[model samples]
Target chain A: MGPSLSIAGLEVRDPRGRVLLSVPALDVPSGALVGVEGPSGAGKSTLLFALAGLVAARGHVRWGAQDILALGSERRAAFRRETIGMIFQDFLLFEELSAADNAALSALFHPRKARAGLRARARENLTRLGLSGTGARNVTSFSGGERQRVAIARAMASNAPVLLADEPTASLDRAAADRLIDDLVTFVRRTGTTLIAVSHDPRLIARMDRVLRITDGTVSGDTTPNTAEGAQ
Target chain B: MMAVWNALPALWQDIVVMLLLLAPSVVLGGVVLRGFAPWPLVRAILWRFRGASVLFVALIAISVGMGIGLLAQERGLRQGTAQAADKFDLVIAAPGSEITVMMASVFLQPSDMALLDGVTYNEIANAPNVAVAAPLAFGDSYGAAPVIGTTAAFASYLAEGHITGRMWATSSEALAGTLVPLDIGDSFTPAHGHGDGADAGAHGGAQLTITGRLAPTGTPWDRAILVPVETVWEVHGLANGHAPERGAQIGPPFDPAYFPGTPAVVVRSDALWANYALRSDFTRDRETMAFFPGAVLAQLYQVLGNIREIMSLLVLVTQMLVTAAVLLGLFILSRLFRRQIALLRALGAPARFVFAVVWSFGAALLLAGAVLGLGTGIGAASVLSRVVSARTDIVITAPLGWAELHFLAGFISVTLILSLVPAVMVLRQPVVPSLRS
Candidate 1:
């Protein structure tokens, strides 16, 4: 359903031109759930930003045969709109908008998606996430767990091939985090959507198909732990 | 909103029509925003920042709307007075300023010009090409409104005027203007001097009978009480304890010792060139002043023109300040929503789309304000015009014209230009850094 990505000479630099990340090469299988594991300040989010072309970087990020980094910024943004759905760590929902409107942003601006079609899909996705009446109420009225669920619903509603979550469970409690991850895994497996989630929580990492461990801005190994080998 | 619509359908329709009329630009602006920002995103963000948006729009509407309305009112004042002035050929007065004569005589307002000898009246009537000379003597008031001492010829000058009760057949009887606010049978004391404040002592306790009422004339004269010259002279003679000799006529040896001063003389000449000749002679004379009312009006309008320029400058500055208010509002919104903009960008909103979102919000605020202001301004102008017309007898009607159209167009353009201030701020931030943290 989506392109397998290959990365080479991928590096991220800070405002003062200091190197923040330096990954020489990596590859991601199509339609797979890959967990990015790293310590604090080890460039876990920067890797995703580069792949999405949200930041300036020196890289050859080949999505299938097409080089994502070689494309211009405008085309890269367009490509991301077509292929990627991002979940921010803080769950930055537009408070003035309804939860259904929050989820419908991904396809609301697309040429082929009618407003009614996008809203219908948004309501469907939000209902699946157990937010049945969220289409009419404001987002600020929802709880933290519900807010993240709405964000996950946004990612799912876009129907994009690649779902990138930036510590989506960072602020959720133990029970809420467990429930959110379970729903995310279920949705990903059912839809065959490729998910690349970054997290340090052991329980979350223990459920991924494979874990790519990075330390000091470089991939150390394909550290697919023995505990996660039996997970669907 | 639905309940209100169901309860009062007619009121709802009226409100909807009024809103649409006030800000027709909102429809155009909505279409424009759909292309770049898409209506959903622009609308959602605008709802959050609606308070600031509404304030900015109201500021624009009041300033621009009131400015145009006041300008049109001023124009009506000038036009009405100018047209009235054109009907008179020349006004003769005591040796003083021409404007005083025009105001005191034709418009029937009080003046301080030293009264000319009744002998001067003889000179105007005897001059070649002189068709009629209606001398005006002012000294008393009926209920504090000016009472004019004029002739039977005064009625012929008005476009529509007729006696209702009967003509003044006695020296103690009076013909009232439509604005006197009295019945034909009632009586009132005539106050001496001008009618501004405390009344001066009357002429021989001059309680006169209201014999007749004249029809309306849309001039200041409508507020006056017209009396026969003999009635005015008799009041003066009675006050001075002198009786008029029974059959006296005006000439060199002023008979009956009647020396009632004439404040103004409205003269009509048979030959057009007679006006220039008469004016030149009076200009050289030491005891008399003569001028065409039209020339006096032109000089007055020159002063009004300078005032118009100053008012126009003030209007322009006020418009700029209104635009600045909109800019300030949008700047605060842009700052408050910086994180949201970054999030939208990370979620695949282009920089162009972000810029469009900021500009569209500003445009909506300004468009709404200007349209509402215009409706309010026009409404005020209409009401004020009628009120002023009734009070002053100067017909005031502010028709919708280029002044209103230009006000709306210029205001919309300037505000749209100022909107770039916030839009540029939205585009200048580094999206990745904001999304990361």
Candidate 2:
């Protein structure tokens, strides 16, 4: 319906002045479950970090129409807190807190109408992700699939328009990975939130509404349809 | 107060040494105490200096020692001055071998008294505007115990405030002052060695009866013996039945009354003529020195001013070192815990909040150290006062004013600086590195 993220002339380089990746332009519409596919060390994760404003790079990363990189550091931080939700490939939950607490922590910088009820919302989100009984348990105790769900739940809990996940299903088995992708896609569709998932998994790649291949830091269009029958 | 009190016993037994040693170092640059303070953070810092606190404590100990030494000198001067005051308007004792030691020990001689233009107690009793004049006779000790012989009129000068008994009358009767409280039935035997032993009868000499008792005054009198000067001469003369009758050619080894001549100590009305210029406060006769123990004490403090200055400088130096150590500890510890701090920053905590969390720990350690230093200082002074008084018969009370001030300044000053240094860095380093390895 509307453009959620627009990247133009994205260029990432290593510290020693070696070219790593270059993307001419890429745009993901809102509510689209876009899959970013690449081999190992192909600048997929770096792309995510740069787009999230977590790294220094020469690029134009626009959220809705505003260029996020153009914002001052302080204002950019505020904007990242408000608009961007990130999920690490490793499910980087704080080891000291429970699953629900980790989910709620993502919204720490977000302003809420009733701040006191944030934890309850976090618990509801965890339950919706099949973590109903694991709400109070530390994320460290969870399996890979469960941790992935927790991460996905946390990303969605922020209610940001753009969600960036790094290999969310890389460590999960087929059944669990399918369930996590189903939850993610269902949530993103229901909330009209745009999703960008990085992975090399062909099953996950095939499930996305659209797929973009990143090779030597270059992205190009793939005209594959969203029909599951043809891919199966 | 509760925490301080609870920390006392432990502080004395264990912490005092570290407190002494590290107190200076902490004052100097010891980091361990500043680190590991219990303030919780998204992350906390730690320092590994167990030895630095010791050095800090030692630096402070010197200050404490010098402070105690000064108090000792002052108290000595006080007792000495009080002694010189009662001896005469001023005491004309031998100047000590050294200038410093001279003030600490000086005694009036009999020949020195003869040089004064003074009158005896009986002669001055009727003088206009005269209250009383009590002559002092000191010399001959009984087993190292000084035997002071003075009249009842001397009691008023010795008494600082209220006491139990009044001055006594009659030659044989004497009153015990606060310094030496003797019951009415107590008898004082004159110490021997003077030629008056044969006429005085037995061991030392004549035995004097105690007729009255004095109240407890916190002055030097509490430690001195009070008796009539007449008894002193009587003891010297050995006034007994054995005395040679009417000067009938008496010599030693002949009759029981025959005795050898010893040093003469007497107080007569006509022989002594002394004028204490009451109008002139400090300027007294140059020939005769009226050593006010208070004045002597002030002078001694001035002389020892250098030592006091050294001690104060040491304290200041240690304070600087402690500040540096705390700063270093903060920087290193903060660096170590940067990731966690960033995480907390990400959690919406402001820079001030993060800094405050870390500073709370430093405050706790400093508080512990301060309590330790103070407890040790006060306790040592108290025990020393008792021991010195017991052994030397000198009542020297340690002055707590400077000790307390130094402790307060040291504790508050160092603690405030240590707590504040690490906190300021938070303002500049607010943004956490986006990807912490």
Backbone atom clashes (below 3 Å) for every candidate: 0, 43
Worst 10 residues of 1 chain A by lDDT: A223-232
lDDT of 1 by residue, A1-232 (tens): 8888899999888879999888899888888788888898888888888888888889788878878789887788777776888897789888878888888876555555455666677788888887887678888988887888888777666577888888878888888888888877777777777888888767777777778887888787676656543254
Instruction: For candidate 1, give the lDDT.
Output: 0.74
Q: How is the predicted docking of candidate 2 categorized under the CAPRI scheme?
A: incorrect
- Stretches of candidate 1 exceeding 4 Å from the true structure: A112-116, A225-231, B1-37, B83-89, B106-109, B116-132, B195-197, B238-259, B268-284, B379-399
**Model 2 Cα lDDT, one tens digit per residue, B297-325:** 55666776776678666755665566566
* CA error at residue B315 for candidate 1, angstroms: 1.9
Cα lDDT of model 1 by residue, B178-199, tens digit = 7778779777667777746636
Report the Cα lDDT for residue A118, model 2: 60
